[model samples]
Target chain A: MLSEFDLIAQYFTRPPRANGQVALGVGDDCALLTPTAGMQLAISSDMLVSGRHFFADVDPYTLGHKSLAVNLSDLAAMGARPLGFTLALALPEARAEWLAPFAKGLLALADLHHCELIGGDTTKGPLNICITIFGETAPGQALRRDAAKIGDDIWVSGTLGDARLALAGYRLNACKNDPDEPLGGQINLDASNHALAAARMHQPTPRVALGLALRGIAHAAIDISDGLIGDLGHILQRSGVGAKLSVDDLPLGAVLAQQPQTIQRHFALAGGDDYELCFTAAAAQREAVLTAAQNASTKVTRIGSIVADPGIAFVAADGTALDLQLSSFDHFRTT
Target chain B: MLSEFDLIAQYFTRPPRANGQVALGVGDDCALLTPTAGMQLAISSDMLVSGRHFFADVDPYTLGHKSLAVNLSDLAAMGARPLGFTLALALPEARAEWLAPFAKGLLALADLHHCELIGGDTTKGPLNICITIFGETAPGQALRRDAAKIGDDIWVSGTLGDARLALAGYRLNACKNDPDEPLGGQINLDASNHALAAARMHQPTPRVALGLALRGIAHAAIDISDGLIGDLGHILQRSGVGAKLSVDDLPLGAVLAQQPQTIQRHFALAGGDDYELCFTAAAAQREAVLTAAQNASTKVTRIGSIVADPGIAFVAADGTALDLQLSSFDHFRTT
Candidate 1:
């Protein structure tokens, strides 16, 4: 196995990291780049620490992919194009065999998105990975959640809650023999869409191109890493408006279609890690978006509509309404 | 405490990030910035975990400043202007008291350098901090270690070995009640120079201004974080050149000059955390650099010259060469 130095030279260091937008990269005391004309940089960051974000025994390759994926999802939500990213890695100890596949996964995503690895530092400690991703967009063209308003049609791409089901399955599988909530090795799915949702749960794809397409077309947008209802609340709150979502209108996949009603409705509204775009558009722009979705072969279901009221409300199948009191995962939460 | 949503709004969501270079910034799903015209972006990153880079009991304010200072030093070494930075902070638990002060120190340094806080993420874990700093310079203008040429004069800013001295005192301070090594709480300095050295150790300043001044003048540059001998070795290895140093020319601060010859030489030649600029310039620029140094009110001492032999040689007071085999601290070294 190569030492950390050899591993860095072989995999991490590239010949003067070249992305089309950079002035200088990789082989310098610092990489340098000039901003392109008529563009703004979009940025976001995420830190994934051992045990907090992933299991210690999880595949390093998967961890690498997921780490970048979550950050890319942020860029997609902002309607920006990936430029490049810097990774800061902390390891308890250097493990050459583990690093190779991990680097492969990280670079693979970088290649797919055309995001070059400009710079990074490696040190020691409990494994921690923090990645800061940069993206570009035309000035004032990036989508934000603050513009959703009354009379706007609310929409979401892909399905919601598949990721949650998959997560449950993963946890259940790990503790199959445990006395508590004893579901065996098989992932316990509530029949809404076991197969598809599980896959969605594990490797949620960021709707990058869709976000770009909706930059001007959509009134406002957010990436649903959190559940749809909660993520949409951001738009409503920022826009000083309200929303009414119908559980019946959701695009629950095959599993939910086959599930019991209670489970299907709950998962459809409250499940997280969709990594899909939840957006709004003026009633007038609806046709254009629908047409665009047809051409792009992606779904943009009008799950609800904006309201003059200033909060979120879920409409039942029979027209009953309930205010959700749940919150998504809070890593830094004190309670 | 407020939910994760409020925490982001209150602390994480910074000023509508208007990096003129970035097309977009925080609060959006992603961040965007255009590289400056004809310039490439220089990038670097580092992470400091609790119990790794510092003691847990150290002041958060100091920790924050040091966290940023270390990353900024990377940019300073490249002679790149400070642009912006992102911080990913992982905590075992949220403490408002800890966070507010930490942000204060981090923000103070960022403002001092005109570097904006572009983006970052937060999570719960064993306190870890990953900082990525982005800066830029015109294409081909960044200083690099590999460009040193034979006959180039080697220069370093400030003095060295003070940080180690400070560390020594800090350790002894922890063991005041013990008589181990026949030492106590009070330092056995030649005078109070050790106190000055200790401060230099604790808060070594990065030489950004001096470095920017040397742009287009210095042939190669690197920041002196590691000891001179070891760090200079990096320049030599990358440039495939050698260096001959006059030990008498080593910049021993007044604090160490009155000490025993061994301690003085060791501290002067082998001290780390100096955060000074160690650069090589063509002989023709010597006068210009000295002039610039005078204007900046900072010292620029030329200790050696790059040679064709491709290794480092130290000429002692007796005119005999000594090979210093000590390597400075490696963050990843296990032993």
Candidate 2:
């Protein structure tokens, strides 16, 4: 059995990066980070528990990727450049096979974004992964959720709901093997579509570049972690404004678009784990928004407009009001 | 049965302090913090598991206090002033009875230190608390473990072994109730002594002020979390220097002072959960060290001196060698 320090040294510790932001890294009582002059620090934390956030037998490699990816998504929402992150993990045991690939997947993403893993703690317990990530943004330049203007156009980056479709497929498969397992509805997908949805669910691409690109163009933003309707509701509630969302105009994931209209609408509107960016911008900046998306090489869709009213008014392509009851993912309220 | 958002709002969320360091607090995708000019941010993370770190039925208030206390102790070791923190908690269920006191204990300590709760994530799982604390210190001023030098006097703050004694008492009680329970040896403590030890174990006072005061005085410092022997080994390993420790000179907790010599030696040397600061400084700065301790209103005791060798040499009051086999706490190797 590996000691806690040995496990951390083998799987997590890395030499300090040349960036010099981290004055002292791992192996210290506390990691020291030199903040960029005149920049504000954007911080966010997310926790993932086995059997709640992810499957007990989910690939450890993907689990590692998703754990850090979800937190990076928050930094992306704030239009902040990645700085570093601290991971606090509770594992059942120190198995080399599980740790090697898990670290590989986690560091692969960290390396891609140049976000160094500065420090963390490891302990023996039920499986849990918590990451607190830091990023840097110019003061007052962060795209806040409460900054959405009344005349702003709502834009979503990439696609939504494929992760939810993947989850439904997993649940459906489990229900087939164990009849006692609750199946919300009869949901099925072909093998290829299942793979596509699963990939989105496991390996989310945080729109960091798009966020940086839209720093000046975007008025307000939030990463679509808890579906479009639910996440956008945060912006509306905080901004003290309402929105008119075109349900038919919602960008569907490639795999999600193949499903029936009812499934597409339900999953796209109410699905969790999308991890795409849902942001608002003035109508005049529509061209700027498109240019920013082009620069970031990410897709953008104008699916709605911020309104002066108090609650969201979902509408069809023909502008007919549609009533859709959707509640965001709540850890306690949900399974 | 509160929703996750409602639970956070009710117990965790607080209005931003007038200090104005937190540009944005809870209810956002990410919290924005404005760093002080020329100050480096000190970050540390700690995770406490239910069964391993604390008793399953322990008081929620103390658990809350200790959860943040342990993290703050890391900052204290780094000589960093409290700034802010992010909490990521996993609970088995959302029960108001548990959360109310837990948050109270946590916030009380946080308020004392002026560490604002900026942002966090809440989820449902086996109870766990992971707090990533932030503090600030001027560049190159942090008392790192690698800065210890030969001929430096090793000093420890407050008391040692009381927490360990308290733990032994609990384990002994458990062993009495269940004979199958492992008891290292027959041990007993009076009720009042147990309470003192228990307080030390549960609500440790992180020496933040002393750490700040010792900025240029202490050469290298580390908080004694994993017992003095294990924690001091880190300094020796990192600094490439050893020490001559006077085991008899270790300041014992008031309750621990009444224990037998063997028990005192064992717990004082290898007992974990002691949040006192163990630091090293040049012999010439003894008066300066005392002044710093006085300024912080914390007691300090010199019990050892750094040596040229690569490992610690335990000694008696008469300077005679004392051979004692002691191993530091390793999360995976211990219990």
Candidate 3:
């Protein structure tokens, strides 16, 4: 096995050749950068550990993409431009093949989104990955959750619930083995749906451009890590407002549409892992938002309205009000 | 018995309030800060994990402080002023008492040093902590490792090897229990003479003021996590220069001076965990560095000079080259 130093060198330190504002990169005491004048720096950090955040047998490449992508979603919520990020990873041992593909997946997104790989640390331990992203936005202009006001239109991008269905092997197409296991059903099912959902769940788009595109335009924003209802409740509580949504208008995917009613509603309301932008905008600017989103090649679907009442209430298709309570994701609630 | 939410609200959320730059802190989707215009952003990140960088039973308080302090030292090395930081902590289970004192220590240092805990994530996993610190400096004027040139004077702050000597438990004090074993010595001693070493080992101060004081004045700088010779070599490689050190000029703490000659040399050359600043400056600015050190209530000792050559060589009191090679902590190399 390659030692830690060799693994770090082979995977991390080649040269700086990415986008966003990367003034100084890796191989130094600390990363350095200059956020443009009139811009405020937006920063967020997250750590993913072995057997906790991912299965021990998971692919390193997917892990790398997920780690960085999650932090980028934080920037998206703040309506800040994606600038660069630092990664600190821990591992039990060094495996060259794993390191090579992992670094490729990591840098590939970095290049795709014009984000610079600034500074990071690699150490020996159980596989733990911590990434911090640095982004910028015009001063006093970044979208804030606390600024959400009553009577605003609540909207979300992309579809919900597919990532949840993927957990059932719907995205993976075929079950790998263990025929008797319930989650292992449909052993011969097509793999494309399962594969697509797996990709979305593991490495969903961060909505960076859509977020920056909403700057000054959207009053409040957040990325949905928890299920739609649960995550939206956060913005409502912090902003001292309430929201009412229609289940009929939810932007769910094809897999979910094909599912029975009960499962579809369950996924739509309680399933998580869709990293789409959920934001609120003024009623007057609704047309402008639709136009801007269209121009950016992203979808914007209005599902409800922020209200004066102080709780999240879901209005079912038949007009019955469902009693709902917010719950945290696994480990987030128990950690 | 407390769960993750209780752990965060009780420990991490309580902290020193930030000043002008930070508009909000903790308990948000993202922390918001507005840096003054005309200032460049300086950033650095680090990660520490239980059973890897630290033992699981190590004092959580000191671990918290040291995690932030090391990155702060990086800011100091660049002559950047402290702004705020994001913390990502992962734990297998939430322990309230452990987190409380840990947050206390971390906030105490942050308050004294004028930094703030902005935002981060708390997740379930083995104990892992990652902190990313942001700082501000004049545009295009941050200190860098590659700026040193031949004939520049090499200097270091505080003493050179107290941290390393303490690790060996030569004559220090009683030590704490190993974090992982509760019985096994994390660095192998009863915290004995090594107590001071271990304490210094655990919480080395970042030289923030010294860095800002040297801004636009010093040629190069770096924080010494990897020990003197090894870290200084980083400067040599980047600057395309060499250095000659006078062993006799190395500053040994009064305790370390009492040790045998061989032990003293070992501490001076190869010991690690001394978070002091090692930097290079023009020979003409030597006096200014001395004056600045006095104002900062620290000593800046000049032990040698950068040379036209491209590697490090030790010069003895007799003015002759030492035959033995000089190297300090290389993380991957087994001692």
The chain A TM-scores for the candidates, taken one by one, are: 0.87, 0.95, 0.89
- Return whichever of 1 and 3 wins on DockQ: 1
Candidate 1 local lDDT, B1-335, one digit each (tens) = 24542474355445643446544455556655565656667788777777756778878777778888888888888888888878788887677788877888888787788788766777778888888888877667788889899889999887766665565555566675544313233345633665786567655677778877888888888876666776787788889999998888887766666666666566567666677888999998999889867765689888889999967788876879886654454211211
- lDDT digits (tens) for residues A232-265 of candidate 3: 8778988999998987888886677766665566
For model 2 chain A, give the 10-residue run with minimal summed lDDT.
Answer: A326-335
Model 1 lDDT tens row, A61-100:
7777777888888888888888888777888877877787
TM-score of chain B of each: 0.87, 0.95, 0.88
The model with the greatest TM-score is 2
Candidate 1: share of reference interface contacts reproduced: 0.81
Worst ten-residue run, lDDT, model 3 chain A?
A180-189
- Give the DockQ-based CAPRI class for model 1: medium
Q: Which digits, one per residue and each the tens of the lDDT, describe model 2 over residues A1-335?
A: 33654565568876777767988899889999999999999999998988888988989899889989998999999999999999998889888888988999999899888899999889889999999999999998999999999989999999988898888887777666544223345456988889989999889999999999999889999998877787899899899999999999999999988887877888888788888999999999999999999999999999999999988888998889998766556211142
For residues B214-271, what per-residue lDDT tens digits would candidate 3 score against the true structure? 8767899987777788878888988889999887788875556766665566666666
**Comparing 1 and 3 on TM-score, the stronger one:** 3
Q: For each of the candidates, what fraction of the native contacts does it recover?
A: 0.81, 0.86, 0.71
Model 3 residue B272 lDDT?
72
Interface RMSD, one decimal, each candidate: 3.2, 1.9, 2.4
Residue pairs with clashing backbones, model 2: none
Give the deviation of candidate 1 from the true structure as CA RMSD.
Answer: 4.1
